[model samples]
Each structure stands twice: as C-alpha cells, then as structure tokens.
Target: MAHHQHHNFEVDGVDDDEVPRNKCRTCLKQNTLTIATVVGVIMGAILGIILKSTKDKWSEREIMYIGYLGEVFLRMLKALILPLIISSLVSAIASLDLSLSRKIAFRAIAYYLTTTFAAVVLGIIMVVAIRPGVGHTEMATKQSEDTRNVTTVDTLLDLVRNMFPPNVMEACIFQTRTDLTSPSPNVTDVYKYNISFETVQNTNILGLVVVAAALGIAIAQLGEEARTMANFFHNLMSVSMKITSWVIFLSPVGIFFLVAAQVLQMDDIGSVMSRLGFYFGTVCLGLAVQGFIVLPLLYVALTRKNPFTFISNMGEAIATAFGTASSSATLPLTIRCLEDKNGVDRRVARFALPIGSTINMDGTALYEAVAAIFIAQVNNVPLDIGTLIAISITATAASIGAAGIPQAGVVTMVMVLETVGLPAKEVGLILAVDWLLDRFRTAINVMGDAFGAGIVYHRSLKELGLLEQSSEEEKFQVDKNNHIDETAQ
Candidate 1:
C-alpha cells in the first residue's frame, strides 16, 4: 500500500481551511473592467434620459461633441484592424499544414452558413406570427430621387471583384463597387444606364482575408525558407494584441459617451415609439431568440460544454460590440476574449474569427428578413408562399455581402425590398430606430463569431495534435540521418 503525504501552510496567520482576503481582492481586481463597463452603460442611459427631458434640443454639432470620446475609441479600433487581420491570419495559417488549414476553413464556412440560414428562418417565423406591420399606415415622406439601381447579378459580381483586388495597397482604403449611372440628358433611352465599377471608401476586408490566406499557404509550403517571414508575422500579431489590450481598457469611458450621445440625437421618441413599437418589439424578440436560445443550443450540442459559461467568458466583447455598433470595430476584442478568456486556441481564433466577422452575419440576416416582410405587410402587399421563400433566400445572401459597419445592413436591405417588389424608399420609415437596432444586432454578430471560433477549435483538436506529432517525428528523423552520415564519413 502506498501512503499519500499532505502539507499545509498558513499565510499571515490564516488557517488552511480559511479563505484569504487577497483571493477575493484578486478576483475583484480581475473583473474590475467588466464591472466598470456595466456601470458606464447604466450611467449613460440615465444621463441621456435626464437630458432628453430638458427644453433645449441638441444640435448635430453638440451631438458630435457628446460622442467625441466614442469617435476616438472607434478610430483607434479601426486603425488596428488592417494590421491585426493580416498578421493574425498569416501567422496562424503559416504554422499549420496545408491539409489541416483546409479542414479548418471548411468547418468554419459550414458553421457560418448553417447559423445564418437558421437565423433567417427564425426571423421569418417570428415576423409571420407576430404580424407587427399588419395594421401600420404609411406616412407621407419625401422620396430621394437618387435611387440606387442595384441588381442581384451586379451585387454578386461586385463581391467576386472585391475578393480579388487588382492592387493590394489600394485595397487597404478602397473596395470596388458597381454603380448605375444615368445616361446623358440628350440620350433617347432614359431607362438605359451605364454600369461603372467604382471605388468606395471602405476597407476591403474580404480581399485582405483571401490574400492573407494565400500568403500563409505559400509560406507553409516553403517550409524552412520562410521561417523568418513567419516569425515576423507572429511577432506582429503579438504586438497588435498588446495594443488592443490597452485600447480595450478605455471601453467603459468610451461606451458611456456613445450611449449618451445616441440618446440625445433622437427626435420625438414618444411619437416614433407609438407608431413603430410593435415592429421594434418583433425585431428584439427575434434577436433574443437567436442569441439566447438558438446559439446556445448549437454550442452545447456541438461541443457538449456549458454554453452559458462560454457566453459569460465573452461578456466584455459582447458589451463592446453593443457600444460600438460595428462588428468590424469589435473584431479585436472578440479575438482577445476568445483566446485569453475562452481558452480557444490561438491558431483557430486568429484564422476563423476574422473570416467569421467578415461573412457570418446571423443577426443581420434575421433583421433584414423581418424588416422586408414588415414592409410588405405595411404596403398591404400580400406575399405568397413563393415571395416568402424569396425573402428568406435574398435576406441570407444579402447579409453575406453586407459590411460589418453600423447601418450596413440597411444598405443591403434595399436589395431585399427590390427583390420582393417593395418600394426602396420605405427604408426611411425605419431609419429612426435603425440606430438602436444596429447596436443590438452587432452584439449578436460578435457573439456568433465568438461561438464559431470555439466550435472550430473544438473540431480541429485532432488534426492539430497530429500535425504537432508529425513535426516532432520529422525532426527526429533528420537528426538521426545526420548522425549516420557524419559517422560514415
């Protein structure tokens, strides 16, 4: 029989079984940032409400001043995005075998598509059941003459064109988008318009991801020759992460001004709520179902882990997403939370999260589906079964093309309306509340990305272990051959 030995030590005259004060202090210290963020949200909301009760209305310039801190925070986060995506993706993929990388990519894309389709279906069911727009009366609003002539074919082409940027440097600041230009006044056919591909002032994230993946694959193939290059990106990723950590510390303060400024900028909240309250409620309910119920069940079923615990680990990132109202801006925090707090692997987190943020828009898909159907109902247009199916398909496709910025979903919402013969100008009706809804959907988008990373990491564990083992075996063989050659000589 073997006996086990036990040793006990007391610190500062405390007994072994007694809880130490330092432990409690350390736990609080660790969670201080999260606590501050919650406080900021509550304080900001209260301050905004109090200010709204005053007689004076806030001007645009005044609103800008109020949100100045938030502006700085957003700029800081956006500035880091380009480097973070490139460095993280390149470094992570370069370390893996080509076959393993392929497996991981396939798994991620499958998960993204599945979740997005589910969100679309859920939104459609909620809108159909709730019937929020059944009794709404159309208001008289001026329609802008500058209607964008967007078609499904043109949109799909633009997606492909942006994926393969002609100039890598230009892609950093501009992405290619097709626009329909009206013919000259003297032209006989007024309906015929020229289709011109123009550059838009937005970061071409999709193109960057594709380029980075190719570069990483080339490096992996080069083996020892690309070791120095791989090291550079690895170090670059580390430095970017460090800077992101520092910026994240400012979130509580930034979020405070952001929420306050958003509240101040609204006009006649009572009137808008009276008219659109049901629509707002419907959207919120769908988002809640997708975020709380659908995503958790998927996570639990796939990983067999406590989804709530995983979500709790990602609280900071979700809160930041709500404050910023832009998933692109929230990418840095999402990556950090997945890797540092959620125990997801660096390789999986880096490789999958950027791609997910760019493409996996579960909340956006749901919102668009609901908004489209709501518009149809408001116009008294009866949508047949075929039309409903069209809405579902279009909403899902449009969301994939939507940018991860604030109000980007509205841009894609135009396509959904046009597909189902709804007036595009009806979008104005929802603009008043879109700002608030954007924040909620963006939070859900970030959550979906985080969940995808966790699932990918879990699924890829076997391949990752095998790759590591093979590398070790290869190294041993090389050493053994060298020893034999030296002795023979």
Candidate 2:
C-alpha cells in the first residue's frame, strides 16, 4: 500500500478530521428530566393509590411527610411556571413573522374557539343528563366576605366581575406568581381572608391571558429595539424551562406528599372513592364520546384522513399529558409528538401548539359546562333558558381560563358559581374528587392537541395533494421486514 498523503484546504477552510459527536450532557439531561417526569408521575400515582387505600394502616406522620414531599415538587414546578409563560409567550408571538402569525392566529382561533364551544356544549348535555349537583345539599358558605365567593348571584354579575383586566403586565406576572404558591401550578389563590371589595384584583385568568396576549401581539408591531428586547425574553423562556426540568426530577417525593395528604383526612375512603368514581366516570365517558364521535367526525368530514392514524402517532404526548396535569408544560411534548410521529410539518406544529395551549382548553371547556350543571343540580339551582345561556357563555369563558394549568377547572367552576349566585365555599366540595377527574381531562386536552395537529396536517396535505389511499403499504413492508429479521435471528 502506498503511503497516504495529508490533505489540506486553507483556501476553502476544510479539514478532514472532523467527526460526528455525541450530544451534550445538557441535552441528554433534558431528555432524562422529561422522561423522569413521566416515570415520576406513574410511580407517584401508584404509591398514592396504595397509601390512600391503606391509610388506616399507615402512620399519620408518614402520610404527612409524603404529602409534604409531593407538595415540594409541585412548588418547584410553580417556581418556573410564571416566567416561562410570560417570557415564552412574549418571545413566541414577538418572533413570529407578522403574516404567518396572522395566518396561524386565524387557524388557531378557528380551531380553538370552535372546539371549546363544542366541549362546553357537550358538558352542558352531560351535566344535564347526569344532574350530579341536584341531589347534594348546598355546602357551608364562606363566613368571610369576598366578592369572588358570590353564591347567590346570577350569571350576569359573574360576567361583570370577570369583564376586564386590571393591569395587563401585573396581572400576568402576579397570576404566574400566585400560582407558584399553590400545589397546582395554575391554582387559584383563594385568600383565607377576603380582600376588601374596593381592592382591585389582578389574579383573574381571563384578564391575565388577555394582557399577555395583547403584549405578545403588540411586540410584533414594536420597533427594532423591541425585537432585541424580545430576544432576551426568549432566552429567559429557555432558562425557565431549564428550571422546570430540574424541579420535575424531584417530582416523586413531591407526589408522595400530595397523595398522602388527600388519603389521610378521609374517614371512609371507600365511600369518598365511590363518589369520585361516579364523577370520573362521568368525565371519562364525556371525553371518550367527544374524542371518538365529535372530533373524529370533524376530522373525517373536513379532511381526507384516518383519525386512528392521528391518534396512534400522538401516543407519547398523550402519555405526557396523562402524567402532568398542566397543558403548558405539555406543549413541547405535544409539538414533538406531532412532528416526529404524526409527520406534521414543524412550522405548523410550532405555530399552533403554544397558542393552543394558551387558549384551546377544550378539556376544561367540557368540564366547565358539565360541572356547572352538576353543581347547579347539587344545589337545586333551577336553570331556565336565560340561566342556561349564561351557564354556556360564562362556562366557556372560564374554560379559556382553564389554560391547561392545574386545578384550573375548579377556579373556573368558582367563576361559574359566582356567575350563577352559588356560594364559592361550595367549591371545596368538588376538590376532593377533582384530582381523579383532572387526569381524564388531561387525556382529553392532549387529544385536543393531537386533533388540532390532525386538522393542520389534513388541510396542508389536501392543499399539497399528498393524501392517498393510506399508509398501509409502507407499514406492511416494515412489519414484514421485522418478522423476517426475527425469524432469521
């Protein structure tokens, strides 16, 4: 063999020794954090089930310790949530090209509002049929004075109360901050002593969202300097996610506490569980029917695609949603699910999901409608035509407030109750059962994310004439090759 001669290209700045490299530890750690979140959720849920069921056999201190640990994980999540929302939102909307943003916005709104409206309507139907709230006695009202606790008003007053934002920037920042203090990242901070009615509050979700959306939208119209400023916020968003990932790693311990606490206080866990079962069953049936019948029907009717393919491709996202009750946290996973599995173009997935996470709370919408009626029935609050209309509208708006955040529906329920003159204190009655229902709602929320992806993909495919008979041929080939390889081995 001849001796090899070295090659160099100073002019072209070429070097032959460059080699493919492994990913950095940060990326690997990011992945670990993500996967760990799912694992923690599963393990925590399992441990919680056992502890809750065997509460009598366990020490009170043990349960409390676990509960506190779970709470700690939740707190960590909250720590990152606010800045993440504001910064990511500001950057996302700010960075979008104006025309594309408009296009995305139009499509996003069309999909989100329409789906949420459908969910609310479905909720109304389920709650009406089940009448969960009708039989239960009205719970004790809050002894303290709080306008938010209005239990005896109609929907009109709640509408008035929620009509406007106080201070846009402050609202979003404070909302983010307030949610941080709760076990739920997006929890409503119902103060023990009510603030003076004269004091203006900025914790309203609608107002906060509105403010964030406005500021975000406004950034695009800002001068060049603002764009530079917006870039900084983008950096902040990334930092926030980093923090969130770190918090998620310790989730197992935090989850233990949350589960332990709930199980600890119950005198007859079985009876409480029976009620929870009924509530969860109601929510699950509603979600299943909506996903299978309604959304799929929309997909089939509107575009040429197999809905089953869409759902199958979104498995990982659904898994993530099942574990983390927050839709915002699930956004990155949802987009990845669509791009990597569903074959959705990144442009659409990226453009659609963040907005969807913000406003497209189809799962919460369903809960609100269903819950409003359930609570109404439980309280024996009769609903005529006007009240029903009020229920539908207020519930729909409150659903917007649901924001894929934690226990968001509960606060929304309070919004509905305050709208319909029900005592806010009645809100706690639903809390005990809310956790189980929250899981199903999360599944549906992910389903909605997947559905939106399907809609976007279907439309794009049709526009490009890419729709064909099916993907079965390639799938068949892959299956056959796998089988042959297995036999050879």
Candidate 3:
C-alpha cells in the first residue's frame, strides 16, 4: 500500500485537529456543576459531624443560622415555580395541536401510574422479605397523642378539591386541606370528629396545572387570533428559565449549609440509628431498586438506549433533589438536564416535567408502602391479603396526592396506617429517620420524572416530526399568499 497523508478540514468553523481537545474542555465545563454539588454534599456532612462532636451543644437558633443560606436558596427556587409551571405548561400545550397534546398527556399519565404501582409493589416485597420491624414491637407502645382522623374518602376528596381551586389567584398561594376538630379534646370518641375544609399555605399545583392546560387548549383552538397570547406565554417561559439558571448556580453553597444544618438539628442520632437501622436500610434498598433497576429498565425497553447513560447525564438534577429534598424545588434543573443534556424535545420536557413533578412519585409510593408495612410489623398488627392490598392501593394513590415537598410523605402515611386499622400516630416511629430517607426518595422521585420525560420524548418523536413539517408548510403558504397580495397592491 502506498503511504498517504490526510489533512483535517474545518467544519462549522472548528478545526478537526482540535476537536478532541475541545470536546474534553466542553465536557469538563458541563460537569463542573455536578462536581461542585458532590463536593458540597461531602463537605457539608464533614462539617456537620465536626460540629456535632464539639463539647458545646448547638441551639436551635444557631442551627437556623447555619441553614439561612439554604433557606434563601429554597425560597428563590420556589419563587420561580408559580411562573415556571404556568408559563411552561401553557406554552408547551399551546404549541401543540389538540390531538398531539392529548396523546402526550395520555402517555405521560400512563407511564406515571405504571411506575408508581410498580414501586409500591416493589416496596411491599422488600418490607415483607426483610421484616425490619418484626423485633421492634416494644417501641410501638409509646404512641404520640396526635392522631389524624381523616379517612381515605376525605383524602381522596381533598385531592379532587385541590385540583379545582375556586380562585386561580388563590391557587397560587393556597391549597385546600380538610381539618378534623373535636369540641372536647379530653373525650376520646373518634366519631365526634367535626370536619372543616380550610385553605393552607401551600401552592395548589394541581389546580394551577388544570387551569394552565385549559388556557393552553383554548389558545390552541383560537388559531392565529391567539398567536400573541401564546407568544407571551412562550416568552414568559423563556424568562423564567433564565432566572432558574441563575438560581441553580447557587446550589453548591446552598446545599452545603442545608446538609450541615440538618445534621446539627438531629437528636440522639446514635440511638435512633441503632433502632431503625434495618428499616432505614430496607427503604434505601427499595429506592435503589426503583430508581436504579426498575426505572432504567423501563427507559431502556422503551427507548432501546443505555438508561444509565441517561441517568448519568442527570447528575446535577438528582444531586439537587437530594440536597433540597423537594422535587418541586428541583424542577428547573430537571427540565434543563432533560432538554440540554439528554436531547429531549423542548415540548416534551416542558409538558411532561411539571406534571410529573406534581403526580409521579415513585419514591414516595415505595417509601410509604414499606413504611406502612413496617408500622404493621412494629405494632404486631395482623394483616391479611386484603389489608395488604388496601395498603398498596392506598399508598399508590396517596403518593399521587402527596406534595412534592420534604416529608410530605409523612402526612400521607397516616392514611395508609388508618386504612388497615393501624394507629395513625405510629408514624412517629419512623420520624427520626424520615429526614435522611426523604432526601434519598426525593432524588429517586426526580429521577423518575426525568426518565418519564425521556420515555415520552422517545415515544412522541414521529408525531413531533409531523407537527414540525405541517407547521413549516403552513408558514410557507401564508408567506406565499402575503407575497401575492403585496404584488397585486
């Protein structure tokens, strides 16, 4: 063979000879955020342990001071959420035709329900097999005085009520919650409960989502008349995203203080861990199976791509979810990672993510299922197949209604306990470890949302391509007609 020399040519204004170096630099720059987040978590833990070991005990106010930065970061993220959800959902749905929008909605909901059910089942299997609470019956006798008198029906009704808030503006700041009060606290009659629905200081996300979807649909139907409105929402979404990006840059510093404060606030950690170690391990195991094995498999089966690679690309979002312990807080990063790093369509990311953050709670479902069973074991309560089935169903449903905030699962866990005749206050048993577990499960929840976006994006590719082609053709025809009219004039 004759010797030959090849010269590299520039493509897209970049020399091929420097491509490898450029790629390496680009990758490092991209991952800087993930690296810093990891470092922040590690440093926070180290600092907390150091503070905990000191001779002087830390006060509540001191711990609050430590977490002030984290609190500000959280508030900033939440401040953007109302605008982000409204703008993103309205813009995403308005951009699509009705049929395509319905198809995507159906797929997203189907994926969410399937994954959540699977998670509940997996958690049941883990708790049943591990038997983490079998030997802890003694602690069950020490019950707290507080009991949630709400029934499953009441919980279900609350879910529906929150979905249709009476006032759109009120939904921005409050969600409806049913409270049970008794005129006589000393009287121990459960039937004497009086129910009242009152607004709580929480964003009615479900209601807002419903309103946004309707607005988007209406805009879509009005055709060209609604162009200005649609454009307004689209521009609003862009501005919200820009603000979100700026907030995310503070994650490392915020997370450091958050983790440190959490550690400083712990009480008798050694004793709590000794008693709850197996329970903690079991919940962690279930989350790992759901987040790592189950979700990734679903993604691979649907997309025929390496799911781990997709997960790897979501490092920053997952880390933020863990550090923040709120999927709602982590929403901005999730959307960014899905669209920018994973190559998901903007329409799919925007449409699927906000809804997923609200309803798709695989981690919460698994944790609640496991915790309910674990509580049963702790109390030596005999549970039949029917009871177990009720637990699974209730856990799945409750997880859907569960808020995307830290420890929201604790509130819903009471319903699961009461459904099977377990004491509502038995939740106190898991309170000590719930803080740590919340972070893990929140990370899994965010991962599930990201995977759902990827799956929906993969499944809707053909429809999206068709929509794009039709849009281009319509634009061409409009321009042609305008040209003819101009020439005639």
TM-score of each: 0.91, 0.68, 0.93
Displacement of residue 403 (Cα, Å) in model 2 is: 5.6
Q: Rank the candidates by TM-score, best first.
A: 3, 1, 2
Tens-digit lDDT track of model 1 for 21-84: 6678876876677778878877877888888888578888988998899789878988888999
Q: How does candidate 3 score on lDDT? A: 0.91
**Candidate 3 has which clashing residue pairs, if any?**
none
Q: Tens digits of per-residue lDDT for model 3 on 348-398?
A: 999999999999999999999999999889888888889889999999989
Kindly indicate the candidate among 2 and 3 with the higher TM-score.
3
Which residue runs of candidate 2 sit more than 4 Å off their true CA positions? 1-42, 52-61, 131-169, 172-227, 237-267, 275-277, 300-303, 306-309, 312-317, 339-351, 379-381, 418-421, 453-489
Superior candidate under lDDT, 2 versus 3: 3
Tens-place lDDT digits, model 2, residues 414-489: 6677666676666665666676677678778778867886686556553323213234667888999999999999
